[model samples]
Target: MLTIWGRINSHNVKKVVWLGEEMGLAYDRRDVGGPFGMDEAYRTLNPNALIPTIEDDGFVLWESNSILRYLAASHGGEAFYPADAQRRASVERWMDWGFSWADAIRPIFFQLVRTEADKRDAALIERSVARAADLSAILDDVLGRQEWLSGDAFGIGDIPVAAYANTWFQLPVERPSRPNFERWYAALQDRAPFRDVVMIPLS
Candidate 1:
């Protein structure tokens, strides 16, 4: 059995849980962040004290995206992670891109909606909106031609990006027209795993 330590509301933690569902793996999840206070045991698993550290067969892993990749490679083989070098690299790029975009926009999101309106930073919100718009345009263009980020088939690469996309769409701000991104998101919404893990109301 696998054990995951993290709050369900965390996007990164959601990615791992979503991937597990996609791979048909059942695991135990322990809440340890957000409203849940940190534990000394969790620090041993993840020194940075980040949500979403996993224990599987005595092997512990941190970094949510890396954890997803590990699960895909170890369980689903090339189907999710891919064995071909070029294909694997292509999928890997989306994961990196997801981190970059999330790091840029998450603060804005946290400040704007997660924090009370009176406490919100207006300038930061504007900047976050701009950055999110730019990021969405790039994704909109890529998704316009393909059914999934990695290719025609869904895989590990889609997990992290899609997790972030949920946040992008859920924010209480106007989004630019993104028909392609919308279409891809619609398809993802139909997936049970995505709905189960990634479609929760924003915190």
Candidate 2:
């Protein structure tokens, strides 16, 4: 059985777990990091001590996006990862971009969800929200032309950003209406595995 070491509430971990669910792969996830605390033994598998370190039949891998790519390529075949060089590159491009966007939105998520409202930095939240909206506008424009960030169909590219979008759409901050972005997100919301895995309440 595949063993995933990470807290389920973690956004990064959600990307890997959600992909596993989407692929219908059997795996077990253990709680670590956050309230669970990290174990010294976890470091042997991942020196970084990150929440998600996957041990798959003895092949250990860290990094959430890399795990997504690996599982899709190995188990999902052309349907999930794609084999064509250009098409694969396109998926890779968005996955990179989406992860970058995750870094950009981390502060926004932490301030609103993780931090107490009275103790939160108002100025930082304001600036970050503005920047996030600008970034969302760019994504909305691209998505307006296609059905998925991974191109015509859903794939690994959409996983990273959608994990973050759960936080974005749930935050109490005022956000500009992003029709195209909302349209894509609605479709993601409809998927059974997506709702089962990625739709958890933010921690």
Q: Global lDDT of each model?
A: 0.89, 0.90
Name model 2 segments beyond 4 Å from true.
Answer: none
TM-score computed on alpha carbons, candidate 1: 0.97
- Model 2 over residues 1-203: C-alpha lDDT tens digits? 98998998999899999999999899999999898988779888899978798999999999998999999988899989989999999989988888668876889999988898799998988988888898899889989999998999999989998998878898888999999999999999989878988898888
**TM-scores, one per candidate:** 0.97, 0.97
Instruction: List where candidate 1 sits over 4 angstroms from the true fold.
Output: none
lDDT of 1: 0.89
lDDT by residue (tens digit), candidate 1, 1-203: 99999899899999999999988898999999888979887887789989899999999999998898899989888789889999999999999899878976798769965899899888888888888888889989999888899897999888888998888888778889999999989999999999989999888
